[model samples]
Target: IMHLPFRGRLKLLVASLTAIILLTWLYLLAGNLENGRSLLLSPCLSETPEARVLERVVLESRVREMEEENRQIRLQLNQLQGTVGQPADGGNYGNAAWGASADTGPEDVENTAEERANHTECPRSPTILKCELIHVACVCAGHNASRDVVTLVKSILFHRRNPLHFHFITDAVANQILSSLFQSWMVPSVQVSFYDADELKSEVSWIPNKHYSGIYGLMKLTLTKALPSDLTKVIVLDTDITFATDIAELWAIFRKFTDKQVIGLVENQSDWYLGNLWKNHKPWPALGRGFNTGVILLYLERLRRIGWEQMWRLTAERELMSMLSTSLADQDIFNAFIKQNPVLVHQLPCFWNVQLSDHTRSEQCYTEVSDLKVIHWNSPKKLRVKNKHVEFFRNLYLTFLEYDGNLLRRELFGCPSQATSESVRLQGALEELDEDDQCYDFRRERITVHRVHLYFLQYEYTPAGDDTDVTLVAQLSMDRLQMLEAICKHWEGPISLALYMSDAEAQQFLRYAQASEVLKNRKNVGYHIVYKEGQFYPVNLVRNVALRNANTPYVFLADVDFLPMYGLYDYLRHFLSILQLGCNVTKCYVKKSRVLNTFQKHCMQSSSKLLLTHLYTSLSPCRPRYHVWTKGHAPTNYAKWRTATTPYKVEWEADFEPYVVVKRDCPEYDQRFVGFGWNKVSHIMELDAQEYDLMVLPNAFMIHMPHAPSFDISKFRSSPGYRYCLQTLKEEFHQDLSRKYGAAALKYLTAQRNI
Candidate 1:
């Protein structure tokens, strides 16, 4: 037999009493209890009128009053018995064991309170909190353990006595985790109905527990049909909750709403989140907030009137679970229900189930909510902080909260002293920092340095005997000259082509660059150039221009104000040898220029006079005006060139490995000549990677002259233009040598034939 509680039994009794009273009254009024089928009768019989009619009426009234009193007493007895204990075997009826029935005398009615007090000692039923079902159905899913649900059950039975009966619904069939917990938390008064839905499976079976087979829903439908005619509502809850306190408080919120509305917890509204829900095919009202049925209060009559249970069964059979699974089964159905009929849902504070993240950014995130009746924790994030102190404090707070009563008295400062020893240590450190009036240094406690952080200082020196007025091609702005000229002076390399701004203008550019913020922290290498209109320096022209401005016997095409990192003397010696060598060598060029408005400046190799002569039949002279720079195409077979390198090969991270480059200037000065523009290093790198035999001096790498100063060409022309004189000499030599060698060889051959 399906067991219904006292409420259901009372409903049946009341119906039966009403029916009997009506029939008997009608029969007596019709003067006959039998054969009065045609007319409804009252219990006022004329045949027995002479037989003390007035007395009988008085007796009937007394009997009715007595019956009413008896019913009231029975209700009280049943309530007391239910609170103290569950009915033994078949419900608490039939036997006169626990309490009295209508047949019992007034004595039993008098002792009902005494009986209730006595039964209260039968274990369970500690603090009685009133409860009424709000949501009739809820589903808990996910394959993970649901320990919170077990705790929730314990709180309901032992603490609050709310849900008279609960239907534990899940797609998981007897999940060991949830099953074990349920058994452990089972109490006397609350009945747990478990429905195993192992039979229901779907094709898209990724979801572990699926109720798409309609078995669980059908089972609930059966239960609803067999409901002992008492319960007007049902409630459903998910398993992912921690019930640290009574749930009666949550249920009471729903009870205030009338049966016309289905009440649930409100999910905070945000358009972004709602849009995603709409995409997921969940029924979210376009106009208002959505609800989370984590705890739901449902009205059964409303559902029955709409045939909701049958409709759920139909949808389940039609294989609609896949589309609905995005929001999960229970959520989807609840959302649909709300959309169809707008319901009243309310939101609880986040403390009810606060979602914790990596650092817990919420206000008062670290502070434990003393009034937090439940928490979701979300995931394992709370346990993963590196600060041991924070973790210790968090653990202590959670532990204290897990148990009953306040362990630490609150201070006037709103701080609690009850904490773990580890937490205390951390707190002490924090207090020290606070007292010192300083902020905690997070970096000092957590950072470390290694070998990669080491740096080498490049020292520079120049011999005192060296010439002070030696012309050095330095492309520099005035500020850089200040930083680098002392070293240039020490090296006896006089500034020749100082391509730069005056000190004041350079200072202004420096301030402007700093204010722009892009180049503020970087080294201003000074040779950075931006061409004006009509100033295209086709690589070769720019080099010729810089070289043309020089008046020294030997010029090093250098950048503005860049001091060689170190080993400058050795580099110059090597360079001198290479200059003496004419054209029998190859080298790389390093183009060091910052991004300008759009275009890039050309190379160091562009200015190499010997290389230019060897590669180009026609050469252009550097004009003071209207001349552009050009970089010559790299010579074929140059890729095979090799060089010897220094301890630190200046060409770093190139495709080539470092090899020593013979210092032609220092030893074999007759094998090479000076090259110019910026790409000279590139050529050297190309040859270096190919492992060529031609010596490339890797030591004492050049410190490029940055934007060397412009000269008054008029004054340069007035001086005995050394560059022009050299070009004239080259032209004279080529003409004289070709004539002399060819004519002599022809004359000698003709004489030998005549002989």
Candidate 2:
């Protein structure tokens, strides 16, 4: 009905035409819009353009999938961080990326192990790889030396954690046989090289081991021909002996110094040279002084550069001629060298490379060393060898190693695959059960075998006249008897007990004592009737008597003034057990009065009430003395004592009261008691001579009974002026002995009860 105007009349016709065109255009547009909607809704595309659009959609979907995987990995990393308390790569992303590259699988780990086993060396070394190389060399001229050299090598190689190569330069080619036997075993980090006569260059032109002109000639062959010139450094050992401990620690000590080329393990053996020399040209510098050359660290490079080889050759020629004319050998030349070159060497610990002769020929010798690195048996042709005492040498030999046919092999190389060390077995002796024999009841028969046996010898006498106060004396006697009874009742069979009297007037007392069921036929209990013309030191007489009478493994001297308790046995047994375990000596201590006093002050409070109160009052008569005792309080400075336990406690009770005085400078005392007092104290204190196996046990009763007549103090009143003389002796000599000897003298005194 509407007409588009084309200017009035024209509008009518244009309107009609416009209307027709609009209607037609509208219909066509509707059709095209519907087709587009259908194409957008359809799952399948027909045109190339639609397919191209679908490809774009597929690529976007793939990108979203990759993003999801990355998110999962990040979540896993966070979870791992929570568990390990650290980042997966130990921190930063750079390390993590690198770690990812190398982490193939466990199969790769196995392959690497196989490669190592099959002789493939890896170029990529581990960052933590460490090297510990030790070179050992020894000179062997004959017989047992080959065996000893092998043993030392074995000991070192057995302990080595890193690879070690041992080169032995011996005149005896037979050593290669021994070396081959050792090498045949399944051991890592070890190699053996033998330098025989055929390998060496001899200036003298002699057949190596059969007959060297002398010691110098032998040394010359070793220096000039046998040893390698390129050998930079090495530990040189002598033949013979075994090790009691590890040598690696000694080696480490040498390694700590940059200038360790000429160090040697030293012993107190050098000190004995003074007596040996008898002023023979001042004993060869190091000869009577410092290190022993038996065990040495030679810087082969330095040695060669210094012309040591040439020097030795020239010296050998001269010494060989001199020896043929004068009968002296290598020691003289060595002595001269030692004097000339004093600063070239350093002395190591005594335990390393010790000479067996140090324990044998030297006075005050120490037979037991805690750890042995090397052993030098340097005396086949010397005076000590000529004067060899088999018993002494046998004991020394037994002490160093767990003996067997293979002990030589074990000492030098370490135990064979089947051999086990017996240190634990020896230590187990402290226990009351035999590990070897399950059927043996060690508790009943040999219990406390290593415990110290304390003895207190006592004698009784009634003064001739009743002119003096006898109550103190009688009371003292009863107290002594009660203390002895208490100790006997408590310790019983573990300790030895004895009583002696010179006067037959006390025959009834003796008869009753001898008849007493406790004393009759008892192994540890006995009585003696000694008839002496005049008064003598009771302790000295008793000790001499006990040494003769007792057959027990050990004995200690007890004073009559001490009252022993049952706990003493247990304490001492435990203490000695630890010492035996550590291969050390247990020191016996008299429980101190001052320490007990401190216990009474702080511990005796109602809240902390302990047995210290009763122990202090009961054990006071024992007269324990410690340097810690102070006048202010009982010296409670028990910390000064070498306690067996970490948190220490005072054990034995001792009295400050002096024992009987022996007359000094008296021929009888010295002649009768050779090992008593000063001599004994000196020997016990000797750093060299002392046997650490013996220990003083604190647990048993070292009970002192002042009332007991261990000494006939009544004789002091009867003899008048003799009282002052004897009192002076008691105060000066006996007290001094007590202070110096401590409990060691008690062990000897305990012997008196046996007498």
Candidate 3:
């Protein structure tokens, strides 16, 4: 510390302070660099895999944030550089600029201000993107049209997340309802405006009114004048159409149009134009090039240039209109215009506008449902359709309407006031009326039957059933008379022994039955012999014959060798008697039932429906081989039988062809399955397709009698022709099912089973 002058000391102090400040700055910069490095390596030292994953997710989120910021910056830069296109009318239409932009003059700002004032009352989204807004137009002139509009609007809103402006060309009443609906829904990113249909009608007065098409058709022609001049393009849709995908995706079609193309539309699915317009004359070069107007993309700017008045003049020309199909009306006009100037029209994919007029044509045009963006119920309105395909579309329409503040309240809830009052009145009247007068009108009701069958006698052994009597339809041979006699002696129930064989074999069976004391002495038993000449067993044919010939309203199609357990016939008759009163019986099977060894003498002597039921009830809750029958078995309550039942067409039950108790009216067994493969299962599947309910009885069981193997394994293995025939028959059954129900029906059946 040297003593220095005061000025020197002050200068030294200032210099020292400056040096410390610089050092502090350097240290801070180094510390920040070290912190950055540590942060970069922290993920590597994460204590657990979850921490590392979380760190990566955070980094990804940050990266996305930065990318979005960068995009915004670029957009701002482009806007400042004047790359966004200006509106042709020099007004701000609130549409995002995409094309090149130009410098705005004072006049432009003034015009924009004026336009904004005019649309100040119109609702708009505060956070809409700076992109071109989609303009959509629809006509609402009648109650049906109004309802359709509500559904269409809801569908669009459900699928579209982009900003749009909906222009509704409608009457005053519809406009009010639409406005109220939009307000109630609190829809976002959408601005709705109404244009009077009467205005368009007045403008196009020169065009003659056609019964084939209403004034709604003329409203579409006025889009060039009806819409604001600022709108460059618009998507015109029919009220009857519903959107399945984003409206923005359909709006993108406008970009695909060439410079010369003014409209984009899907081709007409039907040949109405070719058949009606081009008939009895040399068809035009574009005869089949007609387009449907259900979904149309109009280039409003181009239409303005072409002059809407000019189009109206063409429509007014009686001779020109006469040349086109009167039935087609406006569609014919559009086709004629496109024919003359094909360059003006752009053909779109058929899926964009799936016209639901002819199902065959629609199926041929759009093969996959995923490809459909919009469904147009054109010919038969959705409300009037009865076909399944049309019904599906109708359901979608109703669902959308329901979503839109229950627009279908009357249809779905049935006018609450009237329904409630009527129901209360009916209840009161019924209480006062006598029960005897409450007769049901069952004349129009038809019973649906579920069919099932049993395959038996593959090993050739007699079954024991001293307490049960059931119709035993057996495919007989000359050697099986002893087996039949034994079965007849054991079973105490009525028997319809159906024998399917050659004429000689049938005669032999009849002679044997006549001679056997067991069969002839039993007054309840009868024999039906059907002569079938073939090496292959026509089991299904004989089963069908037995089913038809059986006198009982309820029939059990079982093999001759099957033995009904002790209480099986008693329980079955009880169940059937109740079923005949009201229930529609489809399929019935026993619980915990199995095929026992034919050589086991003790099993046949001791086994009965009662013993089986007791054994099943005593066992643990483990699943049995045939668990469906015993699943819901309550010995005392018959109504609980349904609990043990499952859908007959389920995957697990695909091969479970047990003895089925079916009503007489069930569809006959398929006779094409001449051999063992699919004879029983095919009939069960057909019944399942008919949507019949099935039942399972746990208390009543039947033991299948073991028989010799009917199919010769060695022969089948060596014979390719036999295997091929089996495969061919299966394929034919599949083809028949497809032709009747549809190719998707089989797929749906499999899917249902998996679920």
Better of 2 and 3 by lDDT: 3
Task: Please identify model 2 stretches exceeding 4 Å from their true place.
Answer: 1-131, 141-143, 148-150, 171-176, 198-201, 204-217, 220-225, 256-287, 314-331, 358-368, 371-373, 379-755
Model 1: CA > 4 A from native: 1-143, 146-148, 154-164, 170-188, 199-230, 269-272, 276-287, 310-328, 344-371, 377-755
User: What does the lDDT come to for candidate 1?
Assistant: 0.36
When sorted by lDDT, best at the front, the candidate numbers are: 3, 2, 1
**What is candidate 1's lDDT per residue for 691-722, written digit by digit as tens?**
33432333233223335433423323454543
TM-score of 3: 0.36
lDDT of 3 by residue, 407-450 (tens): 22222122112233433554465565444532111100111111
The best candidate by TM-score is 3
In lDDT terms, which candidate is top? 3
User: Taking the candidates one at a time, how many backbone clashes does each contain?
Assistant: 88, 50, 13
lDDT of 2 at 492: 41
Alpha carbon lDDT at 433, candidate 1 = 52
TM-score of each: 0.28, 0.31, 0.36
